[model samples]
Target chain A: MLGAFFTGSAIVERQRLGLAARATLLLLCSGLSLVDSLHQANGSLDVLGRLSVLVAIAILAVVAGAAWPQSVWVPVAEAASVAVLVMANAGPHQPLLPYLLAPALEAGLIAGVRGAVATAGAAAAMFLAASPFEIRKGQSLTYSSTASEWVLLALATGLLAAWARRLGVRTAGSNEAYPAAYRLMTQLRTVSRHLSGGLDALSLAHIVLQQLRDRTGFDRAAVFVPGPEGELVVLAGEGNVPDWDTSLASDGLMAEVWSQQRGAARQSGFSGTKGLVSMALPLTIGARTVGVVALERRFKWEMEDDIDSLTSILDEAALRIETALLFSEIRTIATAEERRRLAREIHDGIAQELAFLGYVLDDLAARSEQEDMQGELRDLRAQVTRVVGDLRLSIFELRSEVQGQTGLGAALSDYVRSIGAASAMTVHLVLDETPNRLPVEAEAELLRIAQESVTNARKHSGAQNLWVTCRINPPAARLTIEDDGTGLGTGRDDSYGIQIMRERADRLGATLSISTRPEGGTKVDVALQARPVEIASDQGAGRDQ
Target chain B: MTTVILVDDHELIRQGLRRAFERDADFEVVGEAGTATEALRLIGELQPGVAIVDIRLPDANGLDLVKRLRAGSEKMGIVVLTMYSGDEHLFGALEAGASAFVSKDAPAEDIVAAARHAAVSPRAFTASDLAEAMKRRLEPTGPRLSPREREVLAMLAQGLGVAAIAKQLFISESTTKTHISKIYEKLGATNRAQALMSALRLGLIRQDPSPDRP
Candidate 1:
C-alpha cells in the first residue's frame, strides 16, 4: 500500500518524472518489500531468498523502462519481466502481484490507454497460465481468487494512468494557445489606440483615393462631395490633369453619377476631352450617396471588372469614411461651440464688468469739481479705456475662426488687420493663395500657428513694423511673420507660444523655424510639404504614354 | 437738444451713458430699455432722435432690431454699441442699416460724436475703422502665381504667341505650354485672353501701356 501511494504521487506531482527520481522511488519500494519478506521469515533465507532476487530484477527492469520511456517496446519488456516475477510468488499471499501493476502504470503514462491495456493483458495472461502450474506444485487451493484480484488490480491502475495522460495533453494544448491569444489582444489594443486618436475626414478621403488608384490604375482621380450650393467640389485628388475642374456642374457626368447613384464610364470624345477616358462612380453609404469618385485613364479599355472591384472596395470602406466625416463634423461643431461659450463668458462677465468700470470712471471724472482732481480722474479713465479696448480685442480673437466661406487667407487678413488697427505698430500683409485650398484641418492648424506668432510679436516684440506673408499652393504652403522688433531675447527659448507653435506644426507634419534675421528682426517661417502619397510614378507613366 | 433712447441689457452702461449725456446740453436721455421688446416699445413712445443699441440683447440680436427700427422709420438714427469690434460685426451692423457703429470700449465722447453723426445724417454709415478696413479689403487679394507663371502671364498679356513666349523665356515650348496651362488652371480660365483678363483684374499682371487702351 505504501509503494502504491509513493508511485501514484510521483506520477501526479511531476508532469514527467525524471529517470533518477523514478529509480529512487522504485528502489525504495523494493527495499520495503525485501524488509517485509525478511521479517515474515524470521531473518531466515526461506521466503526472502526468492523474493530478493525477483525484487532486484523487477527494480532493474522498471528503471530501464523509465530510462527509455518514449519507446513502446521498453514498456512491454518491463511488463513481461514483472509478470514473470509475479507468477514466481503468486500462490497464496501474492506479494509480487502488486509489483506487476507498476509496469502497467508506466506503460499507460508513456503510451496512454493502448499501452496500458496491452501490458495489463499480458500480465493477466501470464498470471493465469502460471496459476495452474503453481496449483499443480501443491502451492494452495485459493490461487484462483488471488489471480482474479491481481488482474483486477492491474486493470484499475491502467485506467488511472490513462486519466492522468489525458489531463497532461489538455494542459499542453492550452500552453500552445496562449501566444496566439496574446497576439490577438495586442492587435486589438493597437487598433483601439488609433480609433481613439480621432481619425479625420481628409485622411480618410486620401486613403480612399489611394486605394482607388492602387486597384484601378487610373491616371488621375479626384474625390468630390456636394458643395453648399449642391455642386460637386473636389475634396481630394491625385495625378496631373491640367484641365482638372475644381467644381463640376450640376448636369456633369460626376453629378449624374451622384444623383442617379450608379457608376458610368465614358469614352474621351464624349466629354470633348482628348486622350482620356473618364469614369464616375458614386460613393454610397447604404442608400444615400455621399460623394463621387471621378477617375480618368489614358487609354480606353474594358472597365466592367475595374468598376466591379472599385465598387466592392468603396463599399467596404464607405462606412469608415462616413464615420470619419461625421466625427470631423462633430469635432468642428464642438470646437466652435466651446469657442462661442468662451467668447460669451468673456463678453458677458469680464467685458461687461470692465465696461461698467470704465463708465463709472467716466462718471467720476465728470463729477469731480477741482481741476487737478478732474485731471487725475481723466487719466484713470484713459487707462480704463485702454483696458476695455484690449478686452474687446480679446473677445474678437476668441470669436474669430476659419469658418465656412472664410478661407484661411481671409481669416488671417481680418485678424492681422484688426491687430494693426488696435496696436501702434504698422502691419503689412501679403496674401498669395492658390485657388485650391488645403484640407480644413491643416488650414485650421496653420491659422492657429499664425495667430500665436502674431500675438507673441504684438505682446513681446517692441517692433514698429510687422510683415505677414502667406503663400499657399495645394498640398503645400508657407507662412512667414517677420517683425522689425527686438530679436528673441535671452532666457525666452522655451516660451509657451513657441511650444504651442511647435506642437501645432508637428500635428500638421509641417516645419516651423524661428530665427533672428540679420536685418535686425525676428522671423518665423512655417512650411508644409505635399503629402507623400505615391503619385509621382503614376504621373510619370501617364505623361510617357 | 437731440433726445436719445438707450437700448442696452446692462443698467450700469445706461446709467454711465446717461451721466455722460447729462453733462452735455445738446443730448437728452428720454428713456432706457434692457430688452429689445422694451426698447422697441420705448422707442415707439419716445421717438428719440437716436437709439443707442447694443449688438447683443437678451431678447433679439441688436442688428435685427436695428433692421426692424430702420424698416419702421427710415429717418430714425440707430447707433450700434457693443463689445464686438470684428469686421463681420461692423459689416453686419452696416448692412442692417445702422447709422453708426461704435465699440463699447470707445470713450463716451466718441459715442456722443457717433450719435451726433447719426442724428445729422442717418442715411450715412460711419465707424472709426471703416476707412482703414475698406482700404485693406480693396487691396488685391487673389490666387498666388509662381514667378515663372507670372512671367508667362505677362507675356500672354502682351499678346505674345506660345512659341514666341517660349523663346523669350528660354524654356522649351512644352514647358511654356505647361506653365500657361497651370496659369489658366490657377486663374480658372480656359484661353490665353481669359487668363490675361483674370490676371489683370486680380492685379496679378498689370495692363500694358497701349495708346488705345484707355
Candidate 2:
C-alpha cells in the first residue's frame, strides 16, 4: 500500500509512460486479498484484522490504478500489493505458501531483475513471520517445500526481467534516431532534385538557404564566398538581421572558420553580437575551402542538436554551389562557340558573294565607255558599299566572343581601330592591362558593357570622337566610355542599351554610372569594387593537356 | 605582258576578272581554277607570272593557299583577292608572304594595278585603299608615345629645327634629339617628311588647313 502511494506521486510528477502494467498488478493483488479476508471472516478471524487488510488492499488498488507508467515506484506498489495478498490468505486450506511467490513474480514482470530480487526478499521475511502459526498446525513440511519453490520462481522471473530490459533499450534508441535519419534522407533527395533542374548560381544559393532555414530553423543564415586577396564576402543571407556587412573582415568569426577550414562556435559578446550564439562552418570543395557558412540564434541548450546536423547539410549545399557554378561556365563557353560559328557563316557566305558581284559590275562598266553607263555603275557601287558596311557591322557583333589567343584589351584595341577607319569620328582606346586578366565571365561582361556604350555613342550621340578607357588595379577595375557629342537628355535610361548595360554590370557586381559631362558629352563608367579571384587548381588547368 | 592565272570559287567572278584583264594589252589570262587544289596544280604546271587568288576558296582559306604557294616559289606574284576588307585578313595575307592584296569589291583598275605592281616589283604591293587601311591600322588608338615625344613630333612637323624645338620646350638639344629618334622609331619613319606624314595620318597632329607655300 505504501509502495502504491509513492508510485502514484512519482507518476504525477514525472508523467512517464507504461501505466497499464503497474495498474494490473495492483488490481489483481487487491481483489484477491479482499476475497481472502472475506473468506476468513466466517472463520475464527477477528473483525479488526479483516477490516484492516480490506482497507489496505482498497487503498493500494486505488493508488496504483491511478499511477502513470514507467515510474520508479510502480514495481514497489506491485510488490507491496502481492505481500498483502499472500499474508491475508496465509492458512493450510488455501496454502498461502504458494502465494508467497506472487510478489516476486509480479515484480519481475513489472520492473525487471532488481525489483524481483527485492520483492522476493520481502515475501520470504513475511513467510517466516507467519510460519510459526502454520507450524503449530503441523504443516512444517509443506512450508519448507513451498519456500524452496518460491526461490526457484524468483530465479526464473529474474531471467525474464533481464531479457525484457535489453529489448526496451533497443526500442528506445530506434524510437529516437530513426525519424531523424529519415528526415535527413528526404532533405538530401530534395537538394539533388533541385540540382538536376539546372538552377543558376544565385538561385541555387537562395534555394540552399531556404532549405537550411527549413531544416535547422536557425535565427540567421548566410553564405560567404571568397573574394580577391583572401577576403570573404556575403553572397547570400536570410533571417531577421537585415543588411549585414557584405564583406567579412579577416579578423572576424567567419574569417577564422574560413581560414582554418573547420567549424567553430561563439557564445555572445564577440564583436558586438549579443544574446545569440553563432556557429561558422567552412564551405569546402575538394581539398580547398571555397567559402564559409554562418548561422546564429538565441542561446538554448537544445541548439547543440541543430549545430550537428546543420554542418552536414551545409557541406552538401557547398557541393551544389560548385556544380551550379561549373554549369554556368560551360553554358557561357557554348554560347561563345555558337556566336563564332554565326560570324564565320556571315563572313564566308553573303559577304563573299556580294564582293564578287561588285567585281562583275566593275568589269561590265569598264567594257562600256558610255558616260551614262559609268554614272549608273558608280551608283550601284555606292549601294554595294553601304550593304558591305552593314554586313561588316553584323560580323563584328557576332565575333564579340573573346578568343583565348587575346585578352580583352587587345581585342578592344583592334575593334576600336577598325571602327575609327570607317567612321569620321576618331575613336581613342587607352588600356592599362593587368598582369593577370579578370575571370572569363567578368571579362566578357565588361566587353559587352564597353560595346553597348560605344554603339550607343555612334548611333545616338553623334560623337565625333569617343574615348574608351579600361584600367585594372588588383581587386578593383574601371571602364569608361566618353563621347564628345550631345549630352544625355532626360529619360534616356529607358533605352535598351542602358538597360542591358545595367544588367551586365549587376552580373559583375559593378556600379555603373551614366552622366552627361559638363563639357558636352555622355560618359558611361563602370566600377567593380571587389572581384572574384580565380582559384588556381592544377587539375582543372591540366584537363586541357 | 604579265601572265595571270585567276583563282576564285565563283565561275562568274573569274570570268569577270578575266574580262577586266583583257582590256589591258600588257596582261594575259593564262589559266583559271575554281578550287585551291586545282589552282595549286595549275600554278605549278603553268607557272604564271602572277596569280589573283580569292580569299575564300572552295577547299581552303586563301591565306593558307598564299602561304603554301609562297613556300613553293618565291618568284610567283601572289595577290590576295578577298571580299572581307578587315585588317585581320589584310595583315594575315601580307604576313603570309603575299606580294599584294586587293579587295574583290575594289575597282577593276585597282586589281590591274596590283597585278602589275606584283609582276614588276615582287615587293609587298598593297592596293591604295588597302595601303590606307593598313596605315590606319598602324595608327595607335592608344598612346604609343609619351606626351613629350608627341610634342617633339608635332614641332618637327611644324618645320622647327632641333635647336629651335629645344628652345621652345626649354630642354637641351640632346634631349630633344632623343625624343625625335623615339618618335621616328615608333612611327616607323626615317626622315622628317615621313614622320610628319605618319603623324598627320594618325591624327596626333592636325593637318594645317591653310594652303601650303611652294
Candidate 3:
C-alpha cells in the first residue's frame, strides 16, 4: 500500500499536478495502511516500524522523482525503493505489498513491455525472499498463495500501462499528419500559380508585340532594345518587316527616337524600295528609354493619330517590359550564384575529403610490405582517383554557362571537347550558330539539356562513339545527341534525368524526343521553333515592297 | 632543384600536392597560398623557380594570376594546375602565358614532369591534349561567311554607312542592310563594330586598306 502511495505521489510530483490530488492519494493510501497495521499489530514497536518505513520510502521516492523525473535512472530508483519496502515490511500479511505494483506500472509507462516484465520480476523475487522470513517467524502458513496473487496483480497492472503507452504514441503520429498535408497542399498551389503566370521577359515581350499589333494597324512592327554595345537589336518583331539591319547604328532613326525620347517618322521613297514609311517611338518609363518600337507601313499614310495611340500603348506597357527584363536578369544572377555556391561546396567539402583519402591510401600503400595488400590498396586508390575525376567533371558542369560574349556555339564546343577528353568515347561535334543568339535563359536551359543528355549517354550507354550537333538560328535551335551505344533501356523512360530535360524543354516551348536509333544506340533531340510572328514576317518579307 | 610554390584554395589539396612534390627530389616546396593575394605575395617574396597555380582561387581567377605572374617575370616557370580540364581553360592558361597545363587528376609523376618542363622552358607551352585541341581549332567548322558577306563586313569595318555601301555595291539599301545583318549573324556580333572586330580576329578582314590584300 505504501508502495502504491509513493508511486502515485511520485507521478503527481513529476507532473507538477494539483497539491490536492497528491495529498488526497497520499492520505488515502496512508490511512488504509495505518488501519490495516493497527488491526493486526502484535506490538506498538512493530506498528511504528512499519509506519516509519512507509514514510521513509515515500520520502525517498518523492525526492528522487522531483530530482530526476525524466531520467532513465528514475524507474531504476523506483524499483529499488519497492524492493527495500518489501524487505522492511517482511510479513505474510504485509499491508504495503500492493504498493509494489507502483514501480512496475511506472517502469512500463517509461520503458514499455520489457521494463514492465523486468520490474515485476524483481518485485516477485523480493516477495519470494520476504516470504521465507515470514514463514520462519511463523506469522502465516498461506504465504505462497498471497505471494502468487501479488505477483499476478503487479504483472497485470504493468501490462495494462504498457498498452496505454502504445495508444498514446499512435495518437501523436496522427496529430502531425494533418499539418504536413496542409503545408504540401499550400506549396503545390503556389507552384501552380507561378507556372501559369509566365512572367518571363520573352513571353512578356511577345504579349507586348501582340498588343501593339492589335492596337495599331501597321503592316509590320518590331521592338528593339539596346544591346550590350548600345546598338538597337530586335527583341521581338511582327509582320513582313524586311530584314532591317540586325542591329541599328546609334545614328539610325530608331536610335534617334530613343535618344530624343520622342516618336519620329521617316519616308524612304528613294532607292528601289518606294512608298514605304517607317515610324519609331521610344518606350519610356519615368523619363528612361527602355526600348524603341519600329513600325513599318507599305503605303505612305497619315501616321499622326496612329503614333499617338501607339505612344499611349507603349507608355502603359513600358514598365511591365522593364520589370520583366529586370526580373530575368535577377533570376539569371541568382541561378549563377546558386550554381557557384554548389560547386564551391562540392569542391571544398567532398572533393577535398576524397583527395585527402587518396593521399592517406597512398601512405597506407607505402607502409604495407605485403604485395597483395599493396595491390589491394592500389586498386582502392585508383577508385578514389576515378571518383575525384568524376567530381571535377561535376564541378566543371556546374560552373559552365552560356554568356553573352561566348554564345551557344562556343560554349557547346568547349563542353563537348571537355567530354571527349574525359571519356574514352570518340566525340564528333558539329556546331552551326548564327550571330543572333537566343535569350540568355533559353540558352542556359538548352545548354543544361544538352549536358544532361551527354552525361546520360556517357554514364549509361556502352557506346564507343558520341555525336553532338547543334544548329542555332535566332529564335530557332535544334540540338541532337546521338551515340552508338546500347539503345534506351527499359524502365528509364520516366527517369528523373529525362523528366528534368522535358521540364526544361517545356519551359522554352521546345520539343524533346528520346528514341533508339535504327542502326544502334540512342538519340536525344531537342528543337525550338521560331515564334509565329517571325514566320509571318518571313513570308511578308518574301513579297516585293 | 626547381623550387615550387603551390596555390590552391583547398588546404588538403595543397597538402597532397606538397607531399607529391616532397617525394620528388627535383622539386622543393618553397611556399603555399590559399588565395590569389597570398599567392602573389608569396611568389613575389619567394621568386620560386616554378609556381603551381590552381585555376579557381578565392580572390581572383587563376588564369589572371598566371598572366600577372608571367608579366612579373617571363623566366619564372608557371604551371597551371586545375580541376577544369576543358579546352577553354587549357587555352586560357596557354594564352595567359603558362609554361604547362596540368589537370588535378593527373598523376603526381605527370605533375612533377610538367613542373620540370616548366623549369626548363617557361616560354614553351605544353599540355597533354594540346595537339588534339590544336587540331580541333584547325578544323574548318566555324561559320563560313559568303564572299558578299565578307565584302560587306570589310566595308563595315572601313566605316562606310549602310546607304553608301549599298550605292557603292549597286544594291538596294534594304539588300545592303540584309547583307550586313547576315554578316553580323555569321560573325556572332551585335553591331558593325563588333562584326569588324570579330572579322579582324578571324582573319576574314585585315587592318590594311583592303581585305582583298590578304
Candidate 4:
C-alpha cells in the first residue's frame, strides 16, 4: 500500500528511483508483517482474509530481499523471513492445517523455545478463525477434529520449540565457555610436574597471561590488580585499557551473576564510558585471596557464557604464578647459604694460614745472630710449606675442575706416600668400587677426614702402621682410616681435629663411626648415601658455589 | 755406666739425643728400636739400665710402649719424649711405668740427663718437674677442661642413656639425667662426644688404665 505513493512520484522516471522506492516499500511491509505475527489478536480473520494475508506476506518477503543491499538492518530482521513462511503454510484455503515449521525455526533463530511455542498457539488460533466449520464443502470441521488438530499442533509446536531451544542453548554454552573448555583440555593434555627448577614472579605471570590468551579471545585484554592503596592497577595487560567510568559498570554487570559469580553483560547504556567492558574475578590460590583480577575486552558478543571458563582459567593461572614465585625465592635462599659456606671455607682453609705466615715472616725478620737466623730460616721453610698447603686447599675450594686437574686420586696417593717417607710408620691406601665417581661433597669430606686422621696419627699416635680404604656403591660411599697407635692420648683426651671431622659429617647428612682398633690402634669411618647423579652433582655445585 | 735402649719413630731426634748421651761415660746405648714392637722386643733382649723412647712412635703411642716395657721388664727405667704433655698423657705415661714423660722441645742434653738420672732411682727424677708437668696437663690450655674434671665429666659423658651408671650410683634416672644436663651446660656440649671431649680435656676422668675407645 505504501508503494503507491513512491511509484506515482518515480515510476518510468528512472530505473534507479523506481527500484529504490520498491525496495523501501518491501522493507516497510516485511517489518510490518513481523509485528503482526508477534502481536496476538482474538478477533475474526476470515478465510478469504487469511488467504490475502498469505499473498501479502509473500509479496513482503520478495520486496524485503530486494531491499536487502539498501538497508543495513539488524540481524533481528531474520524474523521477517519466519513470518512470511508461517503465513504461506497456513493460507486461507483453510487447508484445515494446525501446525508449521517456520515458526519453530524462527523461534530457534530468534526468541527460542517459549516464543516458538507461543507462535504455534497463535498460528493455530488464526487457522481456526480463518475458516469456521462448514459441512457443505465436505470440510466438516467437527469439534473433536478441531480440538485434536489444535492439540497435536500444540504438542508438535511445543516439542519443536523445546528441541530448537536445547540445540541453541548447547551451542551457546559451548561457544561462551570455549576458552575455559579449551583451557581444561590443554591442562589435561599437559599438566605440569614437580621439579627443583626455579623461576621469578614476572616470568611466571608472563606464562599465566600467555596461557589465558590461548583459551579466550579478547580485544585489548588487560589485567588490573589492587595497588598499595587497594585501588586496582595494571599488573599485566593483554590489550589497551580505555579510561572509562567502568567502576560501577563492571560491578553492576559482572558481579551480579548468581550461579558462577561471573558477570553478565547487557547492551550497557553505561554512560560516560569509552567502549569499556570488564569482568572481575576473585583470584584464589588454595583458599587465600592474594589479589583480585579485573579483565576487560573491547568487543561485542554475548559474553555471559564465558564466565565459567574465564574464572577457572584465571584461578589456575594465579596458583601457578604463586608457585613459580615460591620456587624463585627458594633458589635465592639456597644461593645465599652457598655463599655463607664458601665464606667459612675460605676463612678456615686459606685466610688463617696466610695470617700465620705473616707472623712467621715477622719473627724471621726480628731474629739476630747466625744461629738464630738459621733457626728462623727453618721456621720460614715450614711456613712456606704451610702456605703451599693453604694454596692447594684454596684452589680446590674455588673450582670444581681444579681437583680433577690435580687428580684427586693422584693427590691422595702422593700425600700418603710422602707422609710415609717422612714418618716411621707405613701408610697404605686402597680405593675400590670402580667406574662410578663420588659426589664432590663426598670427595671433600673424605679428603678432610683423611687429612685430619693422618695429622693426628703423626702428631699424637706413636702408631707405626696406617691403613686407609674407600668403598663406593650407588646409594652410598664409605671411607675408613686405621692406625696401630696408642688411642687418643690414653683414650681420654679429645681430638679437636676429630671433632671438626664429625661436624662436617653431620653437615653432609652422612654417618661417622670411630672405634679403637682391636689390635691396639685407631679406626675412623665415614659413610654417605649416594643420591641421583643430577641431584648429587647439582648439590655439590651448590655447595661449591 | 748406665746402659740404655733408644726407641723412637724419628731417627734424627733419636740420633741427635744419642750423640749427647754417648758423650757421657755413665750412659751407653746398648740397643735401638724404631717402634713400640721393636722396643718391647729389645727390652726383652737387651735388659738395659734405662729405655729412652719418643712418646709418639710409628708402631705405637707413648703409653702403650711404656706399659709394654713395664710389664715385660719391670726393672728397666723408661724416659718418654712427646709433643703432647697433657695431664692424661702424663698420668697415662706414669701409670704405664714411664719413669718420666719429657717434652720433644726439651734439649737433647736435658733428655740424656733425665735418662741417665732415671737409671739410678726415682729420686734422680725431679719431683718439681713431675709436679709442674702434671699441673700443666691438669689445667686448661685452650678450651680443654682440667684432668680431674674430665673424669667426673666421663660419668656424665657416657650419655643421657647412662641408666647403668645411674643404677651403679643408686641415683634416680631423672637425677642422673640432670647431671648429664649440667655437664652439657658447663661444656656447651650438645651430645656424647662433646661431653666426652670436655671431660677428657678437663682430666676429670681416669686416663691412665686404658685409651679412649676410638
Top DockQ prediction, candidate number: 1
- DockQ head-to-head 1 vs 2, winner: 1
Candidate 2 positional error at A435, Å: 4.3
Candidate 4 C-alpha lDDT tens digits along B114-196: 78667767323432256644544443333333232344355554443566654655543433444455467657889878767
Per-residue lDDT of candidate 1, residues A264-285 (tens digit): 8877622336677788888897
Model 1 ranges off by over 4 Å: A1-197, A201-315, A369-380, A489-499, A532-545, B67-78, B88-99, B116-126, B137-214
Would you list the rank order by TM-score, best first? 3, 1, 2, 4
TM-score of chain B of 1: 0.73
- The digit string of per-residue lDDT tens for model 3 on B69-187 reads 99999899999987765677889999999999987766565677898999999999999889988886766446566456667777787788999888777766766876787788878
Over 4 Å off in model 4, which ranges?
A1-545, B84-87, B122-133, B136-214
Superposed by TM-score, candidate 1 places the C-alpha of residue A507 at a distance from the truth, in angstroms, of: 3.8
DockQ values for all predictions?
0.19, 0.10, 0.17, 0.01
Q: Judge candidate 1 at residue A309 and give its lDDT.
A: 67
DockQ of candidate 2 compared with the true complex: 0.10
Tens digits of per-residue lDDT for model 2, B85-202: 4577877888888888876656677888889888876665565557667677666553366556766776787788988887887654544665676588778889888888887877
Pick by lDDT: 1 or 2, better one: 1
Per-candidate TM equals 0.58, 0.50, 0.59, 0.25
Q: Model 3 compared with the native: what TM-score?
A: 0.59
Ranking by DockQ: 1, 3, 2, 4
